[model samples]
Target: MASQKPFIAEHIYADAQTGSTPILLIHGFNSNGAQDWDGQQWLAPLKAAGRKIIVVDLPAHGESARVDVPEDATVSKIVATLSEIIDNHGGKADVVGYSLGARLAWALASQRPERVNKLVLGGLSAGDPFAMLDYDAARKFADEGVTPEDEMTAMIASMAMGEGKDSHSLLNLMQGLGREPFDPSVEKPAAPTLLAAGLEDPMAGSVDAIEPFLDNNKTVRVPGDHFSALKSDAFKQETFAFLGIAH
Candidate 1:
């Protein structure tokens, strides 16, 4: 059975306001809330704008490492858990997410449209990349330091085996989520949305497939690749502007 430990969340309330709808920030795969959102300079400015914020560490990542998700977990299952983050607050929020977090946020908004006010999704495309990963090769390479013949497997293995990362847990997470690959057409959100992807990011090259689903949306190209896109000033400014927050 997957461990039922709760996800770790940090709530930062606006100094001058108490009842405003908060913003929920979700980070990408193999990343923590602090490094992804706070470290990227997202928190301070949002606070300055009097926006209450909730930052969460996804299960099996960062502070929530002890929370184990099964190998058969589906996107909807994880989405259900994320919805609790909204429930604990005011039952709804504006969401900002990047990469794998973008996929999850997309699922969250679709699964619970009423819970999302506005959405900012960055570094995302239409499908799940994890679905094509060579799990066996990745596991062997991560466990024994053997080189994986498959390039994608090797790359994912290298990422999972990084310092302070739990390769086994990360692999488990990827395998589970890949069970239900992302398909935007299945369920689309009704919230006003902003989609941003790096100009050189191949991972998000197929973002056009997701555009039609967003009735009220705008798309922007920021400078940087997948890894560096989150830190791009253009991406930050666009996200802040779309959310109506001063940055």
Candidate 2:
């Protein structure tokens, strides 16, 4: 995992010999780029198909710098960082994001439609302001030295899980750091998009609520609750297909 110093991103190059379209994978809250994709075995198929891949660790996660910003980090800051990465790689790249990362991806695509060739968002809802509010409160709790109850922790872990069991430490770190909520006033994405959620997920309501806002989008339901869905083969298949790669 080579580090990008100023941006705090971890670059993972694909093994494919030929140059191809690049795809950026953004992980969810509490989880870094590697943790999100490691269990799903997403890279192997993408690399096999000859696509360039770049996975990043946002501000507070993984090897990135833990900067002290507002409880809810601004979406513009994230977009700026992503834009810089795309520019460095030429001009544009496809993007796939899950949970918190998905929210950022949506903001980025909306802000710079030309920079994203294809976009996919999983485990998120555009209509849920409560989700954002909860994140803010959680961050406050972390700052105040309050430990979240077991139920609350379980609720947080339900967002996304791959192969390994959920880690309380990671969830606590993310909940405490907090994330910015989505602003509906932002422009909707114009790129080809795919939105997905787990069938038994509590967040499913949020995903359904936001469907109308996506200009060009398709939706899919996979097995398991929120966390379990991340490990689904169906998700990987659908994701690869949406990115125009042979699954």
Candidate 3:
């Protein structure tokens, strides 16, 4: 077996001039910072907030496509690397994350509470989606374009096959993430948080399930499904209010 390389994802500061405490945007599975935040039209509003912005492509995704994910890696390892992004900047940030990004944000806040000012965790649910992934089925679909029999794997395939996506690295990320499943009850963050989920998004089951895990938190149901929620105006409004950014 070949040894795995150290995990290093790509990150970029989006603003030309430095301003208030930075806002770090983390994208979800099968998506990159550009598609999730830039393409979804999130940067403009954030820029108007008059704060330094930092955007990151998670390991094995987006600009970080070449980054190798070790089979035994866990979310903690990624969170630690993300923490360095914060440390390299101003040593703290207000985080906004969706789906898998939200899961990682939660872990980052819990592990390093001092580094996070506030959190906007969107499209998060109760159970671990990675744990449910059919790895072999997902890989087959990725490598050979064979449709997966599993519903979740099929759904993932559709998203992973998008333009410029590295399906193989994404599958490897899923495999690593499945090794340590996400559980909201463990190691919670005390920072003020806003948990928003789309009303019709099945992936985010009962957003309130996560309320107990956060000390200062608010939960709201926004319009649209998982994908649409990222682009929803309601989501932006609620998050902006929580972060004290103007509408």
- Quote each prediction's TM-score: 0.91, 0.78, 0.87
Backbone clashes, each candidate: 0, 0, 0
Residues 75-181 of candidate 3: C-alpha lDDT, one tens digit per residue: 87788888998998889999999999998898999899989999999998778877888878887887788888988879865676766777777777777877778
- Candidate 1's TM-score reads 0.91
Predicted structure 3: clash tally? 0
TM-score for candidate 3, residues paired by index: 0.87
Candidates sorted on TM-score, descending: 1, 3, 2
lDDT of 2 at 68: 49
1 or 2, greater by TM-score: 1
Candidate number with greatest lDDT: 1
lDDT of 3: 0.81
| Candidate 2 similarity to native, TM-score | 0.78
lDDT accuracy of residue 35 in candidate 3: 87
Clashing pairs in 2: none
Candidate 1 lDDT, 158-186, residue by residue in tens: 88897677888888888888888888888
